[model samples]
Target chain A: MSERGLLIVLSGPSGVGKGTVRKAIFDSEENDFQYSISMTTRKMREGEVEGVDYYFRTKEEFEAMIEAGEMLEYAQYVGNYYGTPLSYVNQTLDKGKDVFLEIEVQGAEQVKEQVPDGVFIFLTPPDLAELKSRIVGRGTDDHEVIEERMRVAREEIEMMALYDYAVVNDEVPLAVKRIKEIIASEHFRVDRVIGNYIKMLKEM
Target chain B: MSERGLLIVLSGPSGVGKGTVRKAIFDSEENDFQYSISMTTRKMREGEVEGVDYYFRTKEEFEAMIEAGEMLEYAQYVGNYYGTPLSYVNQTLDKGKDVFLEIEVQGAEQVKEQVPDGVFIFLTPPDLAELKSRIVGRGTDDHEVIEERMRVAREEIEMMALYDYAVVNDEVPLAVKRIKEIIASEHFRVDRVIGNYIKMLKEM
Candidate 1:
């Protein structure tokens, strides 16, 4: 097997339950991947450990890292920097540990540009009608806000073209199951493992 | 999901336990695919029902079918003809049922030429040393014969480059599991299922 581990990015349109599915995967007994921790310039909570919960850094440090192009993807939220550290991801993969990242569609796009071989999975709603019901059932947004969210959701879904697999999140367990199978199957892909076999043959 | 079912071709070098692993897959409770029954010109043995064990055909009829390019792949063995019928396989796939074909490496190569989209899985031994021991452990062939067989096995192993996935048949159960995962994953491949999602997006 190649010592380099797979970088699996799980993302989808908003409200597709990407977080729920990701949590389920991590909680499963068979989980063997390292969850990607984000670096943030925001103040860490009392119980949050630096590096464990988040890689807490000074605003200046975050900005410096950004300037150095160390972050795989970053975004400003409430005036705080938040992003994935590309160095950590690469180090984990170099150690042959698979890394799992759950991000928004835009973040995923950014990651794809940097890591072309990453396994990108797009979690999807069962249908547009189901998505609308879920959004309405939230009982939080007003009609206009809900409509705007829907419009953005449709646009994100259109970005499915950029993903490697679109798994329907009709049920969290089923989606997790499919994701796991995809991960396992990817290990045996001819392009990934054939080099070792060819080398072995030559040695023989 | 597309109504067209997957055509899974499981093959490897001789004595790689392709038959055992394939049988295990079918024997499992989750087996849902149609086993591809081969057409043969040899006379049916007692209790071997037509179309169940094999599709019995007269030599003339088989030759005509071969002449018409109806056979997916065929070979002459012990003065009898044996091959998979392309029409039956296509009809089964058109009915939205997966077809599993356990065949030799050469036959699998021919199938690939016909069904480029077929899921071609190469079952491999854990290592060449282990393969040699397995052949020696058989204790049925002379040294020259064993050498010749090993040479053929090496050639077939080289053909791994032509496959979609190469699974090590270290154990029948483990190999079967990997094969199942490969089949399940192939269904969600971006190239295969993206069209449906794209169509749904257009309709929405």
Candidate 2:
């Protein structure tokens, strides 16, 4: 029997290095997993490409997709509309490729509601101290901004309990390896892998 | 923070090579997990050591342990009493070591009743044809016995849907590797690993 692709939802607190982890998974030849590119109303940055990094769109276009229920999950971040297009996700799965979606906790929950079969993974920092250090070490934020980020981090960390699995980003390589292993093991879940076997046996 | 141990219950059909996969986990230095040796009233064979292979006991002694509420799950098989001792399993977990128990499906359900936190894994052969071949290749079972075993195997495979996860024994090394990855991923379950952090944050 041919194996179907998997829908993997990754949610974590900011500064947990999810982007780095996602890049590594994409780079690993053993993965063969696809990344779900999101559509956003936010203007593309200097190096960002339309349809590759994101589907850059105008506010009206983003609103039209949201009204038509074309987006799996959408939200207003800062002042721009950001959302996942369901059509693209379905197309990827149709090609028998595992799809990964990097999103926030609320968006992840929304996707889970639409696709209960999706696997949810939450990434975490090794500890609160390490998390604070990472946020500050980025040098993009001052002490006040770092404090504000930590406040939000605490709230997000509390939501980690809702995830199916948690991986600490203490060491990048170990975390990436563990996440890959989780994705591989999830494919062998009994309900998905054994259904056809049972049907065939019943026919015999 | 110190990591806690998990109680894992593995159940599967005969000839699925559950024993081999279970042994591979113990043999791996990365596991650091322990297996729960069962207590049985069956006569000890040569080279069997008490408290190592099994806790060999008299029928009367086994009955007493049951009466005292010391047994986690027990049943009569071939006129011999076999059971898991609660003390041994608890002691292992209390020391922060994951414990795996290989038991029949019925016994696994019984353990689940007592310990609702236990993780259940079901192993299966790659296919029915492969299963029959494995049983016949054992060379110990006659044709009649092998036929009966195959019938029972069919019934057991039907119960795969009830399991938390199922691993197909396509190849010994691959199956063992998958089982190890499952164990590793389970350790990162958010409810178990992040509860303390969440509680601490709330208190703060």
Best by lDDT: 1
Please provide, for model 1 over B6-70, each residue's C-alpha lDDT reduced to its tens digit, 9 standing for 90 to 100: 99999988888988998899998787799999999999999999989999999999999999999
Name the top DockQ candidate. 2
List CA RMSD, all candidates: 4.7, 5.3
How far off is residue A68 in model 1, in Å? 2.4
Cα distance off (Å), candidate 2, residue B166:
0.7
Candidate 1 residue lDDT tens string, A1-204 = 445899999998888899999999999978889999999999989899998999999999999998999999988889998899999999999998999999988899999999998999988778642554554667887889877766765675568779988788888899999999999998888777776655644543
Predicted structure with the largest TM-score when compared to the true one: 1
lDDT, candidate 2, at A180: 90
lDDT per residue, candidate 2, A1-204, as tens digits?
556688898888777888888888788768788899999999899999999989999999989888898999888889998889999888888777899998977898789889888888998867653553455667887779877866876776767767888888888888889899888878777767676566545543
DockQ of 2: 0.45
Candidate 1 collision pairs: none
Q: What is the lDDT of residue B19 in candidate 2?
A: 84
